[model samples]
Target: MVTSNDLLIKQRSVIKFLAAEGCSAANIHAKMKTVYGEMCISDCAVRKWVRIFKGEDPREIILRDRKRSGSPLSALVTAHQEKVDCMIRANRRVKQKEIANAVGISKERVHHIITTVLGYLKVSARWVPRQLTVEMKAQRKDMCTQLLELSTVCPRMY
Candidate 1:
């Protein structure tokens, strides 16, 4: 249902006319239909290909892409990945939330960069309670073990 010739001749003709007459792309499209028997040219089509021609920086028509606004934060996000890795290397006790706060990004992003980019396996840390009663601490730890066991049993229960 598709073929390359749909684009090939139209592109060449647009470029050729743009180079020859110093005409606005709009005028060229009109002239093509009126003077050259090309009946299908539309204003929007001319606008689209004019961009391609401009992007090529033709020796004749020098067009530039419209300036894009508000670039993605990924471009400016400093790869504190090395810093996070250093922190992980120096002290396995630091929390990912703290690392994210220090790096000015989301905690999930910090976790992702550390685990995915740095190739560091997720680390397990011991949790200690200072003010909890013995019974409360035992209850909390029991709940955690139960959750982990349930995950293993069904792999999706928790």
Candidate 2:
């Protein structure tokens, strides 16, 4: 069976190729739905790609994601990485925009540093460890196994 993920990647490339040919989002959606039948490329995704293509030169529609210019001024400076770290430490619940403003960088850069460098993720308005420890993962897996067993035994209340 073709996994849904594989289908999605295929759909994205097809959509990108179609968009590059100057097909409108609606037209592309219609064509893909007609040609591929069950593989439904979301309208939101098509629209997003259309907008992205518009920003790029029409003649150069690459199927894959393109790289950005570089990190923002505040993020580019090696000194600012430490500053960003301190800011996040000081306020774990700080917003990306707030960090950007304080650090003199774009919200994207703040996000990059947080994820790539600081190795933190914002969950429920708090910065938390992104990856769980191996032991924690194993414990969570065991808990899930018990939950699955319980569900199999119990009758659905609903």
Candidate 3:
């Protein structure tokens, strides 16, 4: 299938060629579609480009073609959010691999939907352990004792 990028590039080239020949936008789109196949270009897209290129104070050519949104859902995602929810609710401790197997999707995809789509999961942050030397531990203990003593108040008699 022709991608939007490819279509845009081809459209620009066709517009430049048609403009040189004094062809109107509608005519240019029809001409290109007829010759280059409808998959490559559309009449409305061509018309929009012509309006921008020829109109006074030419606006940026905004192609109003519907852009594809989001990656195509795999079989796993196709199983429906409800199904995933049901599975998760039934077996909260189900491993990702087992879920993927049950849903016919990759473990990575299973994890992605669990964390991203469901929005009920957290990724653990990488942890770095601190190593305290014996001297440092002793100093910390002494500081705590001194701070506690300093904060203590004595009872007073009338």
lDDT of 1: 0.64
Taking the tens digit of each residue's C-alpha lDDT, what string does model 2 give over 22-140?
89989988887887786787778777767667765355655544678965455557777888888877888888889889878788888888888778887888988688879999999
Clash total of candidate 3? 0
Highest TM-score model number: 1
Better of 1 and 3 by lDDT: 3
Residue lDDT tens for model 3, 1-158: 87777777777777866766789877787778777784656677677667666663357654344678987766345456556656776866667777778877778777677776765453253111134658989999999887777667432421
Collision count for each candidate, in order: 0, 0, 0
Which tens-of-lDDT digit does each residue in 64-143 have in candidate 1? Answer: 33457964544135567677767776777778888887777778778667666665555358222225668999999999
The Cα error of candidate 1 at residue 105, in Å, is 2.6
For all predicted structures, in order, the TM-scores are 0.38, 0.36, 0.36
Model 2: lDDT of residue 22: 86
After superposition, the stretches of candidate 2 with alpha carbons farther than 4 Å from their true spots are: 1-76, 131-158
How does candidate 1 fare on TM-score?
Answer: 0.38
Q: Model 3, which residues run further than 4 Å from truth? A: 1-71, 75-78, 122-158
When sorted by lDDT, best at the front, the candidate numbers are 2, 3, 1
